[model samples]
Target: MSVDPEDIEPTYRWPVPPAGGWTADDLDRLPNLPPHTELIDGMLAFVSPQTMFHSRAIDFFTWHLHSLAPQGLEVVREFTIDIDCHNRPEPDVLVVDEAAILGMEQTRFPAESVLLAIEVVSPDSVARDRSLKPAKYAGAGIPHFWRVENADGRAVVYVYELDPATRGYGAAGIFHARLKVDVPFPIDLDLNEITAKRRRAE
Candidate 1:
């Protein structure tokens, strides 16, 4: 029988890391898996079940990005990025060059090849998405990052760009209603369309 996503638990704790630490190869040995699993600093972190609102937001943003992305770039969802031997994160949405994506053999893409990494926050992922990932992605030298948060049923986009000297991201702006930015590419997004409310049950 198919399992309802909501019925599943939020996170799974993997066993302690081995002497050499958890690597991408370790992920390959696992059996059937859910849609999202990440290795952060040698620890396995399972993504929580997504709410209808969260899933819709991802689809909306991904569609807009696909439509507006620059030539030779493609947007993908939940793609694993190998930041290092001990750190592989799966962002909610990511952008990478078509050529780089085509050349990749392993399931995970090299962090340096990504143009932008995006995360859409859920209640369970607030800390990792808001703070942990920004620092991790910046340290890996990914040039751009975007974070989407849902507040009171509206979507908010936070933009960031890497500062090469510090290897960290500097805030560009927080956008609502409309999102406009120039980094990795130029694009404008309508948050209203992206975060349209779902129908309520009677």
Candidate 2:
């Protein structure tokens, strides 16, 4: 009585990009693009399926950040940053100025409004997360960056702080067991239990 989904011919088509390629604003107008679709160097980069490791690490870091962020800052997860006309990359988590939240419908944050950006490495996103995204975030002058990697079933965080002279991030620390930071507000986290379910004390 009902047509099976696989039996129906897909009517959707991938949009042919303009001569100059897709701009950041095109991301808003594109049809059927998957969530967290990125525009880098005027090209579209689709987000790959997430793993448990990736999702949990995001939850862990974002949870800690939301709890500790300063009064005038807000923590957001899985939102894109409108870095420029050609780049709108989404970090796993970000801390932004409270004023930058224009409304409930706003989808992207201005780069200058962001205080910190964090990315969690996935198998499919290794290059972008490790190299491309960080460079872009730094060039935009965001003050802080962190990259989380899965290592032997645990989370390892690489921290960086931007240098006003070079406009690139300088290594802050690499935390495997515990994470402690001063900039972007103080945060201390235990890495060993990052993926474990939090159980409230009785």
Candidate 3:
């Protein structure tokens, strides 16, 4: 069920970006840009459709983060962080200050308000999840980041903490079955739940 990236050009009429490429604010104004479209270095980066593993992993993190996060922190999914004039990439899940709750109408969070940003790696976004986006988040001073990948159909999370001295992230740990962290707040989770389907309420 995966379409070749080259095939999109023939079947889709993408919005024309402006001179010097699209800005962060332009994400709201552009018509025809697909949902979850991101601005990277002033260029639009379209994402592939989600797999069930992606959705389940997001739910697992969102639910646990919501239940355990300290006061004045909130968990949000698929919201863009306004990094600067030209870059606005959306993380799959984010933890931000309660101040980021500007209102129900708020469309994006400022990068400074983000405490932790997490990306569940998609087959199409492996490069961004592993490198590009993390560098951008680090440059904006977001304190923590986690990249989750499917390893033999299980979620394997790579945890990172920002190093202000270098403006880059340092690896904290890699969790195959359990995720335990103390920075930003204490959090312990059973990573296996990401692969287990939630029972439908009948």
Candidate 4:
């Protein structure tokens, strides 16, 4: 049963696993899983299983982003990003500072080092990703976020920066894929191309 969105209690929510409680080893042993899983502030949240369309979009973005090679950026998939005091989420696509990944075979991203975090919103993830997760991302001091809503041909790209009072993100602007704008990866993303791809998929 779906909880009444309005009546759900705050405590009943999920975030990554707790400090001194969950380790990288524990995250690694998650069952032979299909959909990726991550612990955020001690809460176990299951990432949405990918559909073919989702996979295509992911592949396209990862390819393009990685092509910007040696730009001092790292593209990670389904990895835990320590956001802040209250949140640690594994975004579908995470772009972290290359300096942060050095000198280690494996390491957890310190909350502050993330340059961009992306989420592909599925039916189950819409509310949390739209409402709750953004707040958590902002609180952690991460500089940028992009959420892709796949219900339609276009995606809602929420470009945000920190809000000091609420300790959350305030949307800088909302751009749809059909529109023209430079996506803040410090690069130009042709949203029209994304829309065209979506159309081809349909």
Candidate 5:
């Protein structure tokens, strides 16, 4: 029988250790993370809880990104990337440079030359994406980051530009319906379509 997406269990959320710490071995040694858990900054962040809005946003963004088919770029969904020996984050959406993809063996995007990384905020992941993951992504020199917030049957998309000095995302802007970005490539994203699909009753 096919597993129901809504029936899935969520993972645990805990405080992250200090920076410049925790090797890949340390991460691998932990009990196998449930499909919903994402590793961020050497800590486990629970995700994929009961949130249709969040899931819809991710689906919509990926659809729009894939339609672009912009040369020299690739859009990946839920793929783990080894940002460093200590950090491997599976961002919701990734737009990576073609060169970065050429070196990968399978289903991985290199941290470097990642033009944009996007995360859809969940009750369990807001802190990690807004605070922890951005620092790690920026430190690895990722140029841009996007955050999606679903509230009150509406969705908001936030844009963040990476600052190497701070190694964090600087909030650039927010969009309610449509979001456009020149980086990674030139294309427009229609968030309204995604949100509308989510709001439609089952």
Candidate 6:
């Protein structure tokens, strides 16, 4: 018998304020959860069920990223990055050096090793993905960020590159049909292939 993920409830919950807040160590003590749970600013946030289009977008980008990643870097999906004591975000896709993750024992990947972080927006995660994550990733010194959003049944890739002097990302470009970026690595992606058509209800 298989348990439905939706039927399962989180085993742990953060204590209310006035009580001590949750830490990265506290998060690590919890048992494994369904892949959709994330720690944001010391609070646990549950991601809602993803649309088929969202899953396809992640898969599509992961495939192309893996194929075109720089020689020593690898692309990973739904991986946790330990940003600080209070924040551990699992990006939809991230790029890291192959050597940096070798023989790692920690449950979360170190932010220092991350090269690029990408988030594909879901309705439930719109605010966190668009606002919270971008600020946090830049502050952690991650060099690149990409946000994939659905616009009229198509994928729109928004690219950003970090400026060392300012410690913030500068918008590179936004692509509709095709995504092309030269920093970190060269990438050319077709948005059409990754987008899924919404099905009508019976």
lDDT of 3 by residue, 119-160 (tens): 999999999999999999999999999999999899999999
TM-score of each: 0.86, 0.92, 0.91, 0.71, 0.75, 0.85
RMSD of each: 6.5, 3.1, 6.1, 9.5, 7.6, 6.4
lDDT of each structure? 0.85, 0.91, 0.93, 0.65, 0.74, 0.84
Report the alpha-carbon TM-score of model 1 versus the true structure: 0.86
**Candidate that scores best on lDDT:** 3
Clashing pairs for predicted structure model 1, backbone only: none
Model 4 weakest 10-residue run by lDDT: 178-187
Summarize candidate 6's per-residue lDDT along 1-202 as a digit string, tens digits.
Answer: 9999999996765445234556666666666555656778888777888897789988997898899987889888888888998888899998998876766564668999999999999998899988899999999999999999999888898999888999988999989998877778787777898864657899
Candidate 3 matches the true fold with a TM-score of 0.91
Indicate whether candidate 3 or candidate 4 has the larger TM-score.
3
Which stretches of model 3 miss by more than 4 angstroms?
1-12, 197-202
Q: Can you list the residue pairs that collide in candidate 6? A: none
Off by over 4 Å in 4: 1-25, 29-35, 68-70, 84-87, 103-107, 164-166, 178-185, 195-202
Residues 1-202, model 5: lDDT tens digits: 9999889998676445557655544555556556645555556655556578777777777878888857788887787777877677888888877777665556456688678888888887788878888778888888888888876777888898977677767888888877877765766876777666335578
Clashing pairs in 5: none
Clashes of 3: 0
Clashes of 4: 11
Query: Candidate 1, residues 32-93: lDDT per residue as tens digits?
Result: 55558888888888887798768888898789889989888889888898888888899989
Candidate 2 per-residue lDDT over residues 1-202, each given as its tens digit: 9989999897867788899888999999988898889899899998879999998888888898899987999999999999999999999999999999999999899999999999999999999988899999999999999999998888899999999999998999999999988887888888887766669999
